[model samples]
Target chain A: MKDTNDWKQICSEYLANVDAALVNATVEEKQQILNDITIHLNERYHELSDEEQTWEHYQQILTDLGPVEDYAELLNEKSPDKKKFQKHRKAFWILLCAGIGCVSVLACSIGFFSHSAIKKARESKRPVVVKTFPAALDRTVDPDTTEITVTFDQPMMNFSWSWVGGGEHFPETTGQPRYDKERTTCTLPVKLKPGHWYWVGINSEKFVYFQTAKHIPAKPYAILFATADKNGNPTEIPIDYIEETKRVNSK
Target chain B: MNFNNWKIQLRKGLLELVVLKLLSSGQFYGYEMVKTLKTIKGFSIREGNIYPILARLKTDKLVVIEQQVSPDGPVRNSYAITEAGRLMLEKMTAHWKDVIETIDTLTAGDTK
Candidate 1:
């Protein structure tokens, strides 16, 4: 039925010896030769019970078959010698292809990063003005309490201040610009005269243009608002705009 | 004479010829052929050794192999003699008879 431990050990040792001796035989021929021997052993072993199939009997059988080296010589005679070199070259090609695959992946990664860095550099060179507070045009507000705050998509550098039509009619005072930790939001503390309309603009051409911490330049953007009367609480109402802020383009 | 060595030499000369003649009657696998030949005293051979000779016969086109299901439900290699094998066996048999007859005549004259 099943091969005994001794039988299996004998067969394994014999096949290993045969394989070592068969240097010039193809792998397929070696396997077939081993299969034939194994089948012969199995057929003989099955003719007797496990108790009667001794290692001595198996040894005698192997001896009667003659030396395994002789068998290997016969197998080599039947197989071609050129296939050994082909198998060696085939292994080398697999290693070479694996190396090429790794290099291709590394090159693609470098290319992708270079493209991204170039794109980021181009975008950073152009300034963008995002939003302004008190976004009103010709509207009423309490100027004394109104604070102008601007939010940019990215952080900006602190710039010098200038206002048109605000010094004479409005309070002639300007406070330092306070920025958040991100520096994206800038608060301009200005004291204005009540019930007056003012057109305010900030840009590098007329005022001082700001650059980001990374040294990207910013352009001019404006807000228009009208102050509230003395008895009016402009903070109680939302600031409505008659004209929306327009896109800021490079000068 | 060392019995083992004598048997080895004897079988080496006549084994293939005898195997092909046995198969000329009907197909027989390695184990079956060994069992049949074991009936003759001093003709014993390891079943393992039969396969190589069978392979050689097949290479020489004297035998063809087939598979048959054994009673134990396992497939076994069955060897049958080809037309070429029968013709070769016939010639070998005639030559074997001549050699035996000549040897017998010489021995009989020596006894006289």
Candidate 2:
């Protein structure tokens, strides 16, 4: 028959004492005692007719005799001295891994902001600096020729830009020039096939360091920057044609 | 004789051996086995408990089982030890004797 109160109450109250006292009893004797208790409770429970009274009587009996869990604790007096310590270390490792992940995310955010701050300082001293430019840009692709533009953190003025070098392999060295109030705003349009690549650079040639997109030259190209003082003295930053590097698909 | 709780004073672990030695003698039904077993004062046990052991021994082929119709209109399976069981019984007997001798030697004055 189903029990009204959970077995835990029985285990908690009487199991330990019973197990200790009855350790010498045969298996059958122990089973018979448990069986007796079950039958006794069943009879009282059915006779009471009142569910609450039945429940109370059952619990009263159980609260008097503890269960196997209590007895097992006594039996385990010989168990480990290391299990407790191992439990602590295992908990620590889980917490440590969680801490590392949090630290990594924080470090990544700090690194990103620090790099941005350095870039701003570098840009402040220069009249103009180029961030990126086209690789060996193709010289002719009808409309396939991609435009190479220079980007700056701030605006620049009084400058002209030109690109040269259109050769089958350096023979058709065609050159063109363009002008704008701002070099950062100047866009150089060129025509090139997809396979024909070219390189171009931006240089104000003063107070600012110039960087070009150095990559495998599809078809070698260069940019000329002419920034001058109060006079019309052109300081030419010779956009020399660098040879194309072979494209290695590292991936 | 505190009746020494047959369970408590029955030479520690020799209760099963005592049972085995009895079974080695001849075939007997559950009630008969218990009746005979109780004759040895401290060896009293629930007769039903032997049924499970008998079932186990029969399955192990350590004991053979044969059923006879009882007046109750039901069959009673009697148990008799097989050759292997008898051999096991001999070994158990020898082992128990050695155990007692060793225990006596070790316990010395503690022997009752």
Query: Model 2 in CAPRI terms: which quality?
Result: incorrect
- Indicate which candidate wins on DockQ: 1
When only the first chain is scored, the TM-scores of the models are 0.39, 0.24
Judge candidate 2 against the unseen true structure and give its global Cα lDDT, from 0 to 1. 0.43
Compose the digit string of candidate 1's lDDT tens values, residues A179-222.
55465777676777776665566553543335554444566666
Error of 1 at B52 (Å): 1.6
Across B1-112, the per-residue lDDT of candidate 1 in tens digits comes to 3444455667777888889889999988777787788787867665445655676667667888787777965667778999999999999999999999999999999999
DockQ of predicted model 1: 0.07
Candidate 2 per-residue lDDT, tens place, A16-96, comes to 334333343334434433333343334334455444554345544443222222222222222132345456768988999
Report how far residue A125 has shifted in candidate 1, in Å: 72
